[model samples]
Target: MDTAAYALLVFGALAGGFVSGLAGFGTALMALGIWLYVLPPSLAVPLVLICSVVAQTATLPSMWRSFDFTLIWPFIVGGLAGVPVGTLLIAHADPQIFKLGVGLFLLVFPTVLFFNRTPMAFRFGGKVADAGVGFAGGVLGSLAGLSGPLPILWASLRGWGKDERRGIFQIFNWTVLLAALCYQAATGLIELKVIWLALIAFPGTIIGASLGTRLYHALSDRNFGDVVLGLLFLSGVGLVWSTLGLR
Candidate 1:
């Protein structure tokens, strides 16, 4: 990659990583902008895995105490089961449709909680729900390198506030991202240039995720939810545009 592209990735790494740490799921949106600037979407998804995984690892220890392994593990299993399916669909399907679908889905994801009369009782969202969310995460993740919103929404609906919610997101993001990364690597989609960019971006993500863990107290629960929703909306629009080949 050229200096200009590398530079953009560097800036994206620091900014996105910090946001993810603070907000819980902005890294994908942040990196999407820079990745689009430097490469095609197809190439960007695999590259993002490299950076996302590092950020997740960095933030893991801080959030470990807050983790609900029972909740997370089911999703991980489902995500693993779904990644290949998502990858296969992505490999041959039309990109524009994926964008529109994801955009629409994201736009709706955060709103469901606002209007729903009955919330999901604990028992209602059990192993099946976790697996369902995980499968969705893997599918979207493989398609757009974005899959954080679903899990975030699930947590939000459960009355999980800012800090813990972000922690869950960090862990979940890494799970799906690392899984996808492994798939991409096995399939030879990850190029040398992608690895080069990853090397430069990883440290930035690590630092930012660390800082986010420290600054988790700064944001209010309402604000955290709002920001996450807004970012998802904006990122959704961006993804739709990308689907249309506009970005």
Candidate 2:
């Protein structure tokens, strides 16, 4: 690759890894725009998935004490069950319209939450509600590779603390992204070129992820919430931009 492409690749990986480490999600949201400028969607998308898994795994050890299996299992179960359903739905769905709708939701919902600092106090439905959000996230993930928004939004609305929110979404993202990576591998989407690109990107991902984890340790609860909201807002912009590009 030329120096410009190489630089963009490293920069994208760094940004993606940092966001994932700091917020428990958003690797693709931060990286894909830059990567897409240099690589085809075929290569850029899988590379985002691979780097995301790497970033999540690399930073997880720091949050090991906060790992709550009882809290996260329902979401995982619901997500796994929903993936096949989503895969089926993709056959009948209009992908661009689906992305546009999700893009709009991401834009409006986060803007509302950003303005309203008071967290909602509704605590009903317990794990069942969590699972339902996970199921929707899984369907979204399969449909548009967008599994983070619903659960993350639910966590915010439920008034979870920073660590608790991170614990839920981080582990959940790791599981879902890893599963998707494996599916790609099984289906022969992970080719030698992707491997080579990953090799180019891995160093930046690791370094950026490590730096982001340190920053995460420094954030107060309110500040962390702001960061998460900011990322979501940016994700909305990216989604809307991509959807509009199709027209």
TM-score of each: 0.86, 0.91
* Tens-digit lDDT track of model 1 for 44-112: 777677777777777777667766676677777877787887777776877667667877777777666
TM-score of 2: 0.91
Q: Score each candidate by Cα lDDT.
A: 0.74, 0.83
lDDT score of residue 20 within candidate 1? 75
lDDT of 1 at 26: 72
**Cα lDDT for residue 213, candidate 2:** 91
Q: Which portions of model 1 miss their true places by more than 4 Å?
A: 111-125, 244-247
Give one digit per residue, the lDDT tens place, for model 2 in 1-247. Answer: 7999999999999998998888888887789777877897668867887898899999999998977778788888888777766656755887568757877888999899999967685587999999998888777765445678888989888888888889888888888777766766776766779989999999999898988899999999999999998898888787788879942
Looking at model 1, the pairs that clash are none
For candidate 2, the C-alpha RMSD (Å) to the true structure equals: 2.2
lDDT of 2 at 238: 78
Per-residue error for 124 in candidate 2, Å, reads 3.9
lDDT of 1: 0.74
Each model's backbone clash number: 0, 0
